[model samples]
Target: MKRLVGLFAALLLLVGGLASPAQAAGTLNWTAGDSITAYTSAPTTATPGATTIVFENSAATGNTTGMPHTLTFDTSTEGYNHDVSLNILANPFDANNGRHEATVTLTPGRYRYFCSIPGHSTMVGEFVVTDGPGPDPDTTPPTVTAAAAGTQDANGNYVGTATVTVTATDNTGGSGVDKVEYALDSGAFQAYTAPVAVSTAGAHTVRYRATDKSGNASTEGSLAFTVVEPAPEEDTTPPTVNHALAGTQDDDGNYVGSATATLTATDDDSGVDRIEYSLDGGAYTAYTAPVVVSTAGMHMLHYRATDKAGNTSAEKMAHFTVVPAEEPDTTPPTVVAEVDGEQNENDAYVGRATVTVTANDTESEVASIQYALDSGAWLAYTQPVVITGLGAHTVRARATDTAGNTSPEKTVTFTVVGTGSDACEVPDTRTTVVIDGDDTGVPNADTGDGCTINDLIDEYASYPNHAAFVRHVETVTAALVAGGTLTKRQQGTIVRAAARSDIGS
Candidate 1:
């Protein structure tokens, strides 16, 4: 009975030793090729025991590119096991024929593993180790979705480059996601960290996938996009500038009182940014409205413009002159009035007459011109004034200048007469007379009654007074001379005889 108890105690001690974690040894394999993003194959789960890490990157192991690879366990990051210390570098050209191995005792936790190569950050993965038994093994793969981003054109094509972003999510109670990878345009898969930028200008496709720590991979997700060239360089051309001068001007090309200068600027590509101007030789100022140059002198309006692209136009200028306001007009205007008519033999106008008035000013423009007929009230004169009464009449004219100065009055006078067949009658005293170019040798007065000078004076020389009788005698003599009834000498002798006889005096 003492021997049996001793043997049982020994067996119990042996079983307790075997029950400790990391008693058994586990062999894990990792492989890589010419790719820098990830290893071709990797183990995701292991039992808590002495782990033998085997990494290969040789020709026989499909590493035809002869690129180097490493299997290194991370000890710095959180949320992962840090007890294991394993690092193995292998390549086809190395002495070990691209095969390397390391031994590490692993705890019952998660271990983060990756390639230590500088550009192989995406070659990261996670492996879980359990003592003997744990919860149900995680078998569900992580969900992965990809999206394309950049500035897009109207047709959804990227302007310069297209960026691809991949996101992944693992199922609840499942092994955490290991790594995200993407294949650009059907090329080799590369590990994803930041957004992947594709600059080639053409149609492209990115296939993405995510793997969990349980070695389950999600269904491949693809993103399609088109990259286009970027927009042309910014506009380097400056804006065009011009100006217009507007106002009343004199014949000498000088502005009256004030001149208005308006500026305009245009740019076909970037559009105008701003327009600036300087009056005369003053400082430049932003041009918002028309600049009124009221100061009297020769002036130069300088103007220029700038574009949004920082382009500045050459300065341009317009030259003009403004006349000063004139002094007040103290001198009045000058007016002239005149009458026009036809006169009879007695120095009397035959019928009507016309009166004309004119005005002039030296310092100011004529504002109004007025005229009055006889003693009538003054009225504005637009045309010549007419007088139809058969009598004497007068016209007066005046004018006012733009300076409110009235001119002195001016006047003109004229007389008019009536016309009739018997206005002046005369008696004939001759033995013979010429009527309508025919000679009648007989007495012309009282139906062939011969009359002498004495009869001429006594028969028709009666009048209200001496003046009337004298006028009749003179008229009879004048008619006799015109009709050829008597010679000029005889008519004079007859008139003298009538004067000597003195019928009325």
Candidate 2:
């Protein structure tokens, strides 16, 4: 009996040594029907490192012929055969039926427990391994940071579509990050699977948060950034260009002299950057001010304006001309003189005569007309000139233009004769004489109007009565010296004529 008691105690010690300790274990219960679900009061947490899991399968019905039930624990959340099984039962009455136990070495992490039967992974529960008492439960939420990748404009707004990348990290607890969610502005939250695209313009806010496996959610983190829609393709339309002039132009678009050309540019979108212009097909230059064109003949001007977006306007053209200054008039004027009266056969005038002078010019108007009689000073001719001399006389005329041009001098010669001299007979028995191709009578005393010393001298060379002619001339000269009607030159001529007639004393 002592030995038997000793043997029994040894058996009890062996059984106790093989049995699982209840201290480092977790009890989980689930009823398996068509699926598997956790019991109402199943323990969800266990001590870390070498924890024994106690599972109860209270499967009462719904087990088919080929379908079986088993308890499995693994890191896998799906796929029945992929998990490590703790215990499997072919039927509810089989070994370990309705109950299963497993000892697994686990770290501080969450694991999934499911039925290992085909199509039974959907029925599952979670088992968490934790460090022994002391540390609090995983309450530290994950931190999330969101960054955008894109260019920024001068206004500090993001240009175009920006790629928002969200990164979450859990550093405090063994529970890892479950998911990261992001919301744009006040919109609904969406799970972040990849980069988010933000394309709206103006100010925008991106809110993001991370939830850890322990159901702890981080405080909402937000990034405020401005989004701009690329500035509408950079205002591709160029500025319109218009050309203006500061002076009048002729019918042929010719300017009389110098003129300034101004360019005006306009843009409805982006403002004009600068204006460029070319003169007379020359190279292009910036248009800071108006351009002055002074050359003569045809000229061409090309201009264009560029906007801030680097778009250039279509080339514009303007045509014009500049005329040269008028030259000074240097041409001389022409003078014309005329006499108003009939002349005798000897080209002599017997009565009063009138002489008129006129001047003309092509470039400038005639300023004045000057006339001079024989051996006389020049006088301005305002009207016709009258001549009453009986002998040959000459009148000189000249003209001047407004440009200081003097015309060549012109002269007219004419002689005057009495009507009584037409007959070759004396008025009252006077002596007759022939001179050159004319016949005239000489006065006996030179006191009458029938003849004069001039007539005697003129006919002395052609007279057949040379002695008579000389006597008559000498008589007339003595009478003229007494009467003072003849000058010294006339007296000398008469003396020479008397000598030629061989009657000089």
Candidate 3:
């Protein structure tokens, strides 16, 4: 028995020695959420090798709106590496739960990446991959140096302020410098990306160091400088601010359509810091753009400006009159309702019905649309209404104009015939609940896939998280209520039951 055990252990060791080693994967992570203009974090430099790319944009990462963003490598742009084809669309609701990864081999070059979504032209960056580690190891550290720049006074002290800049250089045939760090007055060291500015009226010391990609760190270097306060100037004059109104005027000196007011301020000694304006004696607010007044009446706009020297200009007023357009809009909006779906031989919809309400007003324009399903209470309509229950349905819709005129109601009727297998009966699970003011069968879960309540709830296990599952339940229940499949009370009961379940959680 001992001989047999020794022989087995030797065989195991031989097998382990002969096995192939796993490939080294270099990981590069990126994040973008709640922003349309730029990525929250991105990689600027990487080493050439088998790279694992990761991109994430999710609710936990700060995307509350569930907006999608794409990270697409530029293949058509000139002067960029196109070796790897990568395009990833990420959002909180995507299939991969807003995180995606891919494996690719990277070469030494500059790769350009950007968001392909329209109106996101500012989201662009470059990834530079350096050459792989050479056969000859690099052991030489990088050399760091620091310098100060400022106007010197008679006492050799800098005038007003001093700027300190650091530079690092690697030895010949060595790994490139990775990062530079600096410390102020023996404080904690921080990654240095820009010049350091010191304005205090005293002597200061800046210590800096650099590290190379090969883990070689250079010796710390230091730079000392002194700053002296500059003489102050006296200017008590306030800034001058003026306003001008621009618009087409009628024969009676009344502006037609609208009037735009522009405020201009100038200060010779101290520059203007801010400008504020008030319309119709209202609260003063910061002025950012030209204010346009289109109301059909006379108006007064007040404006003032403040300078950096603590001087404020007196409030000035501009008077103007704006008349309405030639034609008045007193007509109500025209509305129509239509039912659309896949119809069977009897003209009844197959499983579901869709109702669309449209309203148009060329004069004042439609301001809102309201719809009532099956003589129920009116609800604000933002999208097409979908109905799904085996029964006849009626949708009544109306529109309101910007002038507050309501249009006459328009009605559309439709029938929904189920496939006889879409819905299944599930037992009530909750011990105490109320639906439509009745306690009987209070928490029954309806299914369209012929599954039990638990089975149906477990279907959301494939989602990103429990919050996403809850959101889907809310969305589906709201639609069911709109379609008359479930009453508002029943929908609330079902949603509450789902939320209290531990299936997705």
Candidate 4:
């Protein structure tokens, strides 16, 4: 009993830590249940002994029997206590079968050896430990390996004649590199000669298979390398744009509307930096990040791009314009008579004429206009109004803001019926009214057409006018007399206005 307890204590210490790599570790071939005469040839009976032992997958899984018997060893028993067992399941995270020489400690006397398996306890055996680190477990298994790391170059691509360090190591014995050969992706094997060149573009993996001096060959492991072309000439070409992509049609009565357009472009060298744009010969503005537009108007859009080389791309234009559904005019324009006709005798003769006016506004301004004649036809008027044959017409006018806000009607009642030629003398109380395309002279010569003083200064540029303007038109008549350059009506009207002004002044 004393010797037995001492043997158990010795086994406890040895099995506590682990074994070194030199130990021969492997499993013995066994059938079902059996016992051997001895585990080692000469066994020792001392309290403390040293030697190594091994467990092997023995039971033969016949052509038709149940799966081979699973072997398991439990350190639950007092004499067989151990820190942990070599297992693929309940051990360290990285666990694989074939790792040999998992060292274990033991003492003299009958030590129990059991299969580290499930449902196979009857195959357990008792072994005797002798001197030295007990029976050495077979640590020699096919040590599979391949090449070491290759050169990782600047710019992250592999360069030069790539040489892979072809080396293989084993557990107990060093590499048996004689029969070792290399094969590339399922092709025939090549002897482990010199390092092969990996010059192909892109990435590639080379695998090495080491065959020991023994016929035993190790499985293949691979090393990866990358081969890429020098970045394709640095890509410095600038991008271009298309014009047929010009745009949709709209009635601007002027040009095109506002459009945030993208200039289609490409680069073969340094790539495109940005696309700038301008409209209606406007200042060039920064490009839209995603090439979008918000401004509304009819304009000429100019576009361009620049590359990293400081090279500017050819300017392109997308006559793109953003049009409002309808052009807006919001301002309430001041209404004035463009031309007033003659006033006849005392029937309150006030002539109706064209009130030439323009609207001023921003986005979607004045939508419509309303005019009431003598509190009548709140009618829509366009460019001209010929309010005919009225003794006195009360013209009430109002403008509607684009948003439908209507303004107060501006009413003006003027006498249209004039006194007879013998009874009425034309009033000369004229206030100087500055008008566009009118006479510049302050005390301008009056033309007696039975027309008033104001009418003389503001003569029609097209038809009847003062002497200075008449002289201009005569030059045109000279051109016409040579041919049909000027019409007869134009020449005659000029001659009449000049003669009439000379007599009236």
Candidate 5:
């Protein structure tokens, strides 16, 4: 009997040594009432190892049949694990008030603890398992980076298509990166799965962020960039053309002699590539310098310009005429005379006479007109010329053209009779005096009688001084008759014979 008792004591000591301490597992306490389900003090975080959960029922203490309740643990909400469920507690006021205890091995993860009994699922809580002994909390958020490959212009604007890539990283290795999201132009955030393509024009904004598996989110990061339209598909506008010239122009826009037609072309988008021109509706040719148009008469020129982008300008045309040099004038002027007076049968004026001369020319205007009386110096003729002489008078006129050509002299004759006795006096004439018989000495004698005088005048009436010469001849003839040299009839016959002869007086 002593040996058996000694053996039992030794066995008791060994069992006590094998049992674990009450504080070895984390304590999670829960309670249930008449119709309510809740937890007194449940642990939110536990070390990676064994965890203890204590449940108590107190419905019977309230004077009503206690409802049975159960505690369960699961990897996800509403996914209860039958193996981790605690035995049901039915008695409310029994010893220890239906108290129960459960222990479970926990790894590093998040878990859900709730009652699996009908109508008790509402009582739930969260459970987190971590490394042993005051493990560090996941406070560091994830970092996100965004990059793009696109062309940049001088203004820092992105041109053409761009590929945008986003990446996320976490420093906490326990809960790595969860997900990365991005937003464009304040739009809604979307999960970033692949590279994004940006192909629009103008400015834009991008926002990105990342989250860690431990529910830690990073601050949003922003990036600004501009997208410009692709270089305008080959310039399509044509070049402009300008033309200039240096020379004298006529009323018809015509230039005389040689002249240069200068052409200039300009383009706004693309530089001018070439210039072409055509003359008189002829074939087109490239132009390098000013064109020389030396031909006379009307001319038509067609020109155009093209840009480097293969754009051609509308055809432009210009018209001009050229004149030749002037020639010299060689035509002489014509002169016309006008007389203002009454004329006799022999073209002798009975009263005062006025004469006017007019000159005209075809090629050049008349320069001057000159007039002269018989045997008188020439004078410029501004107005009409008046002739007041009492005998036959002569007038001469001539004209000169602007080209220095002088016309032949033109002459006209007119006569004026005065209202006096001297006006009847015969004009001076040339005649001879003769005697019928020889008279040695003849003193002053009576001239021939009136009948002899009349015969002498009638014989030499056509002579200029016939009347004067006739009187002298009569006197000489009478001297001879008085000296007994000739008879009266003979004297008259001798005077008439002298007037008929061409002898000196």
Candidate 6:
């Protein structure tokens, strides 16, 4: 029995070694269901020092202008093992389906998010955290336009086949649409409700709804599609399209797509007014502005303009007639080619910018200017570069315009100068002191190099450092000994005079 127990312990240790720091599942499932932000984000960015724990209110319940939801993380525990909660429910406190989404950044380690909201955990959902970027922002929300709610049949009776034409677009790559589903007159909803084959003999009403794995839901307006059996002609007369022209995107469809405007319109009453516009045509809107759509193909301008009085025009009538602004390279001129200052490389005298200025705009004029000093502050200006105090200085330049348009940063290096190293000059020889040769007369400044020995003593006394004075006195004594300049007896006299100090008063 003891042998068997030891063998079991060894096996357990081996199993533990095989595990990784990240969750074993390899993916962190997010919260998704009836009470989730179908078109929002998780793991939203927060300033580094602001808050360590990431948070997002993706629940539909507390999301209605002040619903309560809490999110937090462990910044103190370094190696990443944190708790998460996603047990949100529909109104009236009931557990939702298996769908889930709970996002939070992890420290390259295991993470778990569970609904601590009562019994909802067993039914609602949970999530995990791993080291990877989150979902794609471009994944569109499922279009939820309400199809014509009612349509007539051959019997001239109000009816529904309970089947609506749902166009599902998938972004999981390759797959067009996986599944489609609809509810029957508010009946028990089922999983098989899309692209349905309703076999009702007459008309029926239905509600169509769907979503993608990213949990993007179709809107309410896309809910009901008219169920019909093909009626007679009625959409004749060239189908009068009210306003159709194209330019830029409007507030209505904010989706980021190819920046082109293509349009087609029809007027059952009167023909279209001349489509007049200009691209930089004086700050126009997506609908009300004028643009020169020079490219013959379709494009978006201020799609709609006006005539004499004021008739609403339509642009981008044909959804597919997109313009090619991306081709024109409308990305504002490169700010790089404009600024200057690449000289002296020093902390004191850094930038050598003589005339650092903003470049002339290709599309517009060089508007205004500004500058920054180190990582310190941003300053506005009409000047090219800013210089506070010259020597030992570091500077930067900023160029802008009246439109608050700014140019890229440009560097102009310069440096400050200071006094150089030049020591005090001195003469090699002077008629200041002298010494006679042999055992001769008394010592005197009159013996050789100029000044009297009395004056020399007076000057030496004025020296600030007594030690420096003593050292210079020794040098003078040695010079006398090296002769040529003084006689032997004079040298002796000089040495005696140099060594003697003024004693007492």
Give the C-alpha miss distance for residue 145 in model 6, angstroms: 50
Per residue, candidate 1 scores C-alpha lDDT tens digits across 29-117 of: 88888889988998777888666667788787778766777777788899898776666667776657777655667778888989876
| Residue 108, model 4: Cα distance from true site in angstroms | 32
User: For candidate 1, which ten residues in a row score worst on lDDT?
Assistant: 11-20
> Global CA lDDT of candidate 2, please?
0.65
Give the local distance difference test score of model 3.
0.75
Q: State candidate 2's TM-score.
A: 0.34
Q: TM-score of every model?
A: 0.32, 0.34, 0.29, 0.25, 0.28, 0.19
Off by over 4 Å in 2: 1-43, 48-52, 59-70, 75-98, 102-131, 231-505
Candidate 1 regions off by >4 Å? Answer: 1-24, 133-171, 177-505
Which candidate model has the greater TM-score, 4 or 6? 4
Ranking by lDDT: 3, 1, 2, 5, 4, 6
Tell me how candidate 1 scores on lDDT: 0.73
**Top TM-score: which candidate number?**
2
lDDT of 5 by residue, 103-194 (tens): 65555766666666577666776656667665577888998888877888897777886667888899664456889999988699999989
Best by lDDT: 3
Report every candidate's CA lDDT. Answer: 0.73, 0.65, 0.75, 0.45, 0.65, 0.38
All-Cα superposition RMSD per candidate:
34.0, 38.2, 29.9, 26.8, 39.6, 30.1
> Distance (Å) between predicted and true CA of 135, model 4?
12
| Residue 119, candidate 2: alpha-carbon lDDT | 57
